[model samples]
Target: MLAGIVSAVLAALVFGGVAAPAQADPLPQLATIGSTLYSFGDASLCAGAIDLALEAAPHHPGHVLAHVTPRGYLGGPCGNQVKLGWVGSAGLQTRDVYVYADAAPGETITTDLWVGTGPAKVMAIAWPIRSTFAEWYLLVP
Candidate 1:
């Protein structure tokens, strides 16, 4: 049931550029110990509200799950919407984290990200008016 919901949401993003309904799937409670703030683009032109988490994959050994939720934007004309993505070290495979759609203001998009345990750089890019909004580095354990 949960898998189907997740797959459907991912399909919505990967195939069509449409975002999933904000109230779609619910994830299991994993401890959210901390969060990081990020400002992207030249001279910190834009900022985004996002939360990140890294935890050991419940079943996949040597891999970590990165939970990224793009809450919204701080202020100003942050374009029509924003999107999330990541860059990881070489040889570390990644899945589910490649957010390909735009998230509108006040809309929350949570990703079921799985990647090989290592260092990673998460990024938030603004929409139609293309530009990077924010970025942060995470050491996936």
Candidate 2:
């Protein structure tokens, strides 16, 4: 009888809808402050300084100059004069900015400096080619 009871309990436990323990989500590496986003990969290097600057930007709705780096880039200075565009509910504004290699550390290859109020949508445009570009969204603060 004891063995039968043990078997019955085991069966109930096994067939029941009890779920396993839940898992924790992975932590993000990017550092965000208010409406601004900053990435400082390998905090031990110059990126730390840049990240600090991004964090200190004024918290307001404005047009920002973003620095973007190309993918799979190995080394060297990543600065180039690129045409950038900002799109918001108002309209689209195109301008030029210097895109550097070591801009945003880890999150994405893009970083920004608040220039003025116009639009939140920002991107890097390749001139002449006109076919390739990279984009990022800025939240209004």
Top candidate (TM-score): 1
Query: What C-alpha lDDT values do all the predictions have?
Result: 0.46, 0.40
Candidate 1 lDDT, 12-100, residue by residue in tens? 88889965554322222323333533433222345554455544554453344555555544543342333445565544333333222
TM-score of each: 0.36, 0.34
TM-score, cand. 2 = 0.34
Error of 1 at 44 (Å): 23
What candidate 1 gets wrong by more than 4 Å, as runs, is 1-81, 89-107, 130-132
Clashes of each: 0, 2
Structure candidate 2, residue pairs in collision: 63-116, 78-101
Residue 85, model 1: Cα distance from true site in angstroms: 2.0
Looking at candidate 1, the ten consecutive residues that score lowest on lDDT are: 24-33
Candidate 2 residues 1-141, lDDT tens each?
999999999988987858765432221112223222222222222222121112213333443434343321124223334566657554776765443454333233344544344335555444333223455554433
